[model samples]
Target: MSEHSIEDVTRVVDGVLRSRRSLRAYRPDAVPRAVLEDILDVASSAPSNSNTQPWRVHALAGAPKQALGAALLAAFRENTLPPSPHFPHPLPEEYAQRQRDFGAVYYRTLGIDVADMPARLRQTEKNFGFFGAPVGLIFTIDRRLAPHSWLDLGLLVQNVMIAASARGLGTCPQVSFARFHPVIAQHLAFTEHELTVCGMSLGYPEHDEPVNRMAMPRRGVREFACFDQFE
Candidate 1:
């Protein structure tokens, strides 16, 4: 057993968390299988309630990934904004406002006019292809699990993103995939009990891409946090 300094661990962990963001564009280079395996292994350490680790990840690459994307994109083109399978609940006003702000900034970075509905549809379509990343990941959970399990899944997702960032990889966790759950379910051959939690794109980032440079503002601690009984 080896002991480590608290200051060093805090600095390292904070660095990884702060540096992680949802990337929009990725380089064509393939992420080695070994590297993907190592990231998942580290992410498996994410804590769960009563040690009930409830997360399933389907990693896709090559032709299979392309096939899945094509299926979903076809469904998207035919359908008019399919309802979200997992997040059916309405968002709070503040939360909804933040989402709108993100959309505004993201589209602006791509030089898309706010009223260009067709261009917006094209941008949304890109999500199904994992934004051109070399690897695509679909996360699922058992239908029998309670809402708390969703929290556990979220922790695991965060772990995966942070771990990937630490290894010079970029990732985008997308809920847009939830819109075409039926298409995904058919492509992946998921059982009746397995529900799509979300999809993630993983690969090295194309830093020069304008969309990749888009950064959204985050509320400071004073805005979102409260301290009680501080000494």
Candidate 2:
């Protein structure tokens, strides 16, 4: 057995966490099956509520992934699906402002005008293609589960991204897919009990793509957290 120094582990772990971000474009290189399996194996270690481990991931590639993307794009273009709200009806100004900022920065990076709805819709349609990534992952949970249990799935989702990032792969966790959940569910033949939690795109990031180079700003820890007692 071997014991490693805490300092050694901290630097490596922090490096991985800090380097990860949502990759909007990816290279066409194929991610080997074994690598995907290993990433999930590491992610499966995420803590579960009383060990309930309630997450299910449908990893897609090749033909199936294409089929799902096609169906989702069709649903998007036809404008036939019932609305799936990804945000609150009336978002607080604080949060809404942040969302607006992100949109401005995102479109600015792509050189798309914020006022061009048609151009933006075309870009938004890329979510169905997994943003050109080699792998498309759909995570689900039993629809009957309570909201608290859904937290466990969120943990698993974060783990998946971190694990993949550590392996030098890029990922994007997308709520956009939720709007097309019915299309995904039908294409994947999910049981009625399975509820879509989120979708993720995974693969080697295309650094040449302008979107991949966009950097998002984040609030400091002090802004989002508080200390009850000082050391």
Candidate 3:
């Protein structure tokens, strides 16, 4: 057996990042339970502060998954959802601009013009249905945990996504689902102590869907990264 070179590892990492996207549509096929467990096992290996692994995940599939998605959509339709104040109110101009750009690109990929508000709204609502993915995962953390733990949980989620990618599986980490946390908690029977952090839709991507062809654009490292010790 030959040892992998640094260049080989770098190429693999680049491919993973470039290929991974927020899969909007998935095939109806089911992901095996054992494969799901292996993905979670890889996620668990993510590093955390003081070795405090604060991530909790609820993976659902088949009937139960469909039930949860339907329940959340119902809550959304009934206007009975609670507020999610996780991020700061009134985002900075730069951050807001980037978000707006992402929305524009996303809608365009679906062939939805900016003037078509109803179409955009309908597309956004598809998120509640997990884009018809066969598996849905809800990530949570204790309310008592600090903000850093949420960051740690993010790392874990990234690990899960990357690991899934290596296996030819696709995933979409969804913050939209967090908006219906109350409904999700009730459906999942989560205790008051646990707060929903994020949700992920996982399965095989629908290769034929035009919407799935949208690859989000990213800024170069120099645009976001900075050097230390400014003069």
Tell me, by lDDT, which candidate is best: 2
Clashing pairs in 1: none
Write one digit per residue (lDDT tens) for candidate 1, span 1-231.
Answer: 147688888888899898788998999999999999999999999999998999999999999999999988888888875588554367878788888898899888999987999999999999999999999999998979999999999999999999999999999999988777778888899988888889999999988898877767889998777777565
lDDT of 3 by residue, 4-52 (tens): 8889998998999788988989988899999999999988999999989
Query: After superposing candidate 3, which stretches have Cα over 4 Å from the reference?
Result: 228-231
Model 2: lowest-lDDT 10 consecutive positions: 1-10
Tell me each candidate's TM-score: 0.93, 0.95, 0.93
Candidate 2: RMSD to truth: 1.4
lDDT of 1 at 150: 90
lDDT of 2: 0.91
If the candidates were sorted by their lDDT against the true structure, best first, what order would they fall in? 2, 1, 3
> Model 2, 1-231: lDDT tens per residue?
148688888988999998888999999999999999999999999998899999999999988899899889989999988767767779889999999999999999999999999999999999989998999999999989898888999999999999998988999998888888788888889987998878999999987788988778999999888886856
